[model samples]
Target: MTNELTDRGQERRDSILDAALTVFVRDGYHATKLTDISREAGCSVGTLYTYFENREELLAAVLQKVQAEIGNASDEPLEEDFNRISYADALRASNRAYLVGYRANAKVMALLEQAAHLDEQIYDHRVARIRRYIDRNRRVIEQLSERGEIYPIDDPFMFTTALSVMISRLAYYTWVEGFFDDSDETLERVAKTIDDIWFRSLGLKTD
Candidate 1:
């Protein structure tokens, strides 16, 4: 009985997170309140508190939810299957996935940026999560280098970190910048920038 209750409670928590993401994206995080999320989730404020201690925690939960969704389709092993594909192609493929994920969760991404400014802890966690993800894929990057598909770099880990941060900034500007709306053209530009950086950094020509 206790286990069932716990599971149900968790489900409710997840639902609240989904609703919260929508609200945050629609209204921005600072403008959003627990009451707003509760109403959106079809739960009482008290019920919302039963799962999350505060708005900050709720935002974190929402961010985690978005991250999970973004990674859902990224579970395939790195494309070491064939040796013919250029390193630029592999990098482009990975970055295209990122652009898709960002588009899918634009609202959540906006909310996360808003939350990061209001709370130091949240900001730190967001940075750490990004760095960790890059580190996790460092080996795949090195493997591509080994295949001679891409050029080798002095420190692939740091290169990955820099690349991640740069792409994130590109997405932010493209999506949130005033008078500069995000579009397929902008996404392609960002992808090209990434390819250029990777190609040059690895001593590979853009040809």
Candidate 2:
């Protein structure tokens, strides 16, 4: 279905989505209007409607674009050989990947979190997304524990929830907003601090 769009059509749609993201970020979901997105995209309201049926669809498309750009990178299946790497290497690799991904997409992520609070439908979507990640991590943690690589977590789901919140809030505060210094050194320190916390909590050893 996505392949049906001609290049020009797809470009126009993408432009609309980009504009929608800008308005959503600035004015938030409750305050943003479809006309605002159309104006920002330099398209008429009718044209915008041709691309997206409603604001919800447009917002969903915007989030899908972001997930494809930021979240999908690490969602790729790692090779068997990659999984064969040492426990510590795996932990550090995954943690580093998250820090990099979150840093790169902090603004869009913050917007997503903000939307979750304003709308019940969006809140459900957010909860489902987080639940998916938590389930995956719980399985990974179970595998690592079975392999005797780290301390067994009694409640992997809860741990994943906590870890995800910590990272999300940190990314919002440090990168999206200007609460913390987002310099290279500080990002490095922040990532290291997360790793330290993970290691301390999970009883993970050095590489």
Give per-residue CA lDDT, model 1, range 1-207, as digits (tens): 123447788888778988987888888876888889889999999998777778887788778777766654443324545456554565667667767787767767766777788898689868876876676567667766776756657877778778767767777676665335567777788778866765676666444
Q: For model 2, give the 10-residue run with minimal summed lDDT.
A: 71-80
lDDT, each prediction: 0.72, 0.74
Scored by TM-score, the top model is: 1
RMSD to the true structure for each prediction, in A, is 3.4, 3.1
Which regions in candidate 2 have their CA more than 4 angstroms from the true location?
1-11, 76-80
Across residues 32-144, which tens digit of lDDT does each residue of candidate 2 receive?
89989989999899997787778887887887787665545544432225456765566566666666777876767787777888767667777766676666566667777
